[model samples]
Target: MSTASAHAPAASVAPPPPGPRTEPLLGNMRALRRAPLDYFLAQVREHGDVVRFWLGPKPVTLVAHPDGVRHVLQDNVRNYNKQTRGFAVVRELLGQGLLTSEGDFWLRQRRLAQPAFHRQRLASFASTMVEAAEELATRLDARCAPGAAFDVAEEFNHLTLSVTSRTLFGSDIGASVSRDIGEALARVQAFANARLTQLLPLPRALPLPSHLRMRRDLDMLDRVVRELIERRRADTGTHHDLLAMLMEARDEDTQERMSDTQLRDEVMTLMVAGHETTASALSWTMVLLSRHPDVRRRLETELAQVLQGRSPTVEDLPKLALTRRIIDESMRLFPPAWISSRAALQDDVIGGYHIPAGSFVLVSPWVTHRHPRLWENPEGFDPDRFLPELERERSRFTYFPFGGGPRQCIGNQFSLMEMVLVLATLVSRLRLDLAPGHPFVPAPAITLRPRPGVWMTASRPRAATPASGTGQ
Candidate 1:
């Protein structure tokens, strides 16, 4: 729907919402560079829900209110497009993938890719999710030793990458291949993210060391993805996964076949977005669980009562209430996509503030999810806040970790299921304690990664865990 029709203007137009005073030329860029997350948090806290700030010469309005978030994400979504500097960085790797595509083209691609995430498909993949988690748990058993530390963040990344490769591309990616793909994706995204935050980013055409290395890494990823696409194209009804759907799906009206480029873009989009964001969520959940022993105990009790120490299935997801809640609450605290924005296609009003055409509106979950007006003990980890009754009492936009509306992350359920099963499997077998003296600061890159890695000591749980190891 058009923004003009969706939101009738009030009698008088309000000027851009109040914000920090700008400097001569740098604007709020310096402050943002200094502490990105804190700058966003402070903007919403100090300047009300509709906080305006300048990044370089450009003006940015952060819509921290749920009502405003709804306006931008769902109510008048058409008026906002993914024409932001951030998405441009994403296009460097994703091309015109669904995550970065806009308008009718995005609509067409969404229609084609939608079936891969159908309820039946996801349900069928539950065993795949649990089996992958079970493998990770078995591996962790060997790694666990009293007082020994390893990066659980890395472990989750490998697991999610494995799951994504298998489910999305119908390829059983070996651990070593998963590691290689994960590292290559990291390089490309890390470079893109660094360039995004630069006050004056160097042109990609330049053969700087970082740029050259990223080019190599991106080419490596492209070759791998293209091979998978080729393999699927030659398949004879052997696979019915996402890649096959994208390959075989025909546009309803025009009946246009998906191009090689479009297929590749969508495949990479699912791989990177699915793998990275889910890993971030699981890592944060692990940290939160470790910190909150009471909550962890409650979750353990729930899993014990619900699954009876067996592998979790899709049927068990509902009964694993606290397990799902922990994932929900953890994402609220450390949203992987910490920064999300949409360009104003035309003049619009959100939260009673004028958003002139061409300006950008940022609906950061990082800010909105932690808004004190919207959440109690905004910064504290509390899973019960997501209890069905409590969730029903709140506006949906208030807690959008996977985002919302038509363009919500397509892999949301896929990510959630992966997190729950992984959490259940690992928690049932092992205990992860934060390594002494390691900070929990989040490093905001493509995703809000656990900075410097979540170093943790893993040991066999002496309590709650079943003694049979496999938990028969």
Candidate 2:
């Protein structure tokens, strides 16, 4: 044992290679500022799979291929951490919760939270998802007008916000808090990605415009969470909702449970993450389906045949094949959580390439999911690509809408169930058409959002007129 201890690997490891470099101190910041996604994509095309760039003094390595990404996200995950500058912004709002925390803290929180979203629990939650979708359909039914454009982004935001709030808390949070949180999150994400924010010498504790708004959002969200927890604690009713489950959970080691502050962070993280990504997914789904009438018609037919004006139940989900296919195709085209990053703690060889210690390794789902080598006709929006046989033919990393590996999204199943129900519920009642002269520009932010918002006109299914036809 003593000899083995002495023979163990050296205490201090060697520093990694100072990856491919360019021009003055900060390389290509000016170009990256003009178009972030395009600039990043350009770097991948020029510098091969692993290219090193700088955000001011910091070195960022972009990994475009699946093999390289798998090394960072899965193979050597222990050597990497979520210590990115952008992740710091999220830590501010969410505290040391699962999304930002490392090691034991993250593991403990994940374990306790995991069971609350288990597949069996999700069956109950599916009802809430369908209920929210039904509300959206009802609203659209009341507002159907010919040739009038509606921002589908805003509508979907409302839908997901409602679903998240009702599920997390046993009651509704209304639209006001939901809107505030959305606006605040937008500011925080912009600040997180901005080069100017990175250049600022001040510490993160000091509030910038974005930081100030984020704090306000955190406070607002905290107040809501606190009140909900207090009310649940005081109530004698037995509720099996997520918040109640969290309240009852106790850590086995210390028998310690979540404190109010901890609860606030977890709830806020779920609300922001849950609402924003789902809304973006729904908006993109609408934009993609609007452009492809045959896909839309097929979706409508499937919903009509399977659901037939009835609200979608968990059992109905498997039968809603086309609806699921449509959403799967939409996600393939525009995954909300596009880019994810990890900071390496030590130099390592990943796929014959040397990755240096302290380098920010980017595993971009946006690039890998659509890589020409992995996907056939990668840019096309084809739902058939996700059909069982075709899916089996596709490469594993070729479709990562909710990501892969252990750090894969906990609410992935919940999100999918919510999306299918929402789409089926909405399409069952209404037909949406893209407004004329509107361009759907993909603006990649915290999620890949539609630049000007997804503008469309919705009419009752029977009153629906195709883009070319007059209302019947």
- Model 1 TM-score is 0.95
Least accurate 10 contiguous residues by lDDT in model 2? 463-472
Residue 469 CA error for candidate 1 (Å)?
25
Candidate 2 residue-wise lDDT, 1-472, digit = tens: 0100233333244223234455576565656556777776666666566677777677777777766766666766788899987677667667887678889888888888888888898889888888888888887777686777788898988888888888887767767876776676666666554523445545657767755765676676677778877888899998878898787888878888888877877887788788888999998888888788888777776766676567889999888887888888888888898887788898666534556678787777777767777778878988888879888886566677776767788888889989988988888788888888777777766677888787889887653232321110
Q: Mind sharing the TM-score for model 2?
A: 0.89
| lDDT assessment of candidate 1 | 0.83
Query: Which digits, one per residue and each the tens of the lDDT, describe model 1 over residues 1-472?
Result: 1223445464147566789878888888888888878888887778788878888889888888888888888988988999988898899889999899988899999998888788888887788888889998888788777777788999899888888887876667776877789999988888988988887888899999999999998898899889888877786766766777678789999999899899889888888998899999899998998999888777776777677768888998877777888888999999999879889888887766788888888988898888888899999998888877898999878889888999898888888888888898888777888999778689887799998899888777655653232211
lDDT for model 2: 0.75
Q: Could you list the CA RMSD of all candidates, in the order they appear?
A: 3.3, 5.7
Once fitted onto the true fold, the runs of candidate 2 whose alpha carbons sit more than 4 angstroms away are 1-21, 186-197, 204-211, 462-472
Error of 2 at 209 (Å): 5.2
Worst 10 residues of 1 by lDDT: 463-472
Candidate maximizing TM-score: 1
TM-scores for all candidates: the values are 0.95, 0.89
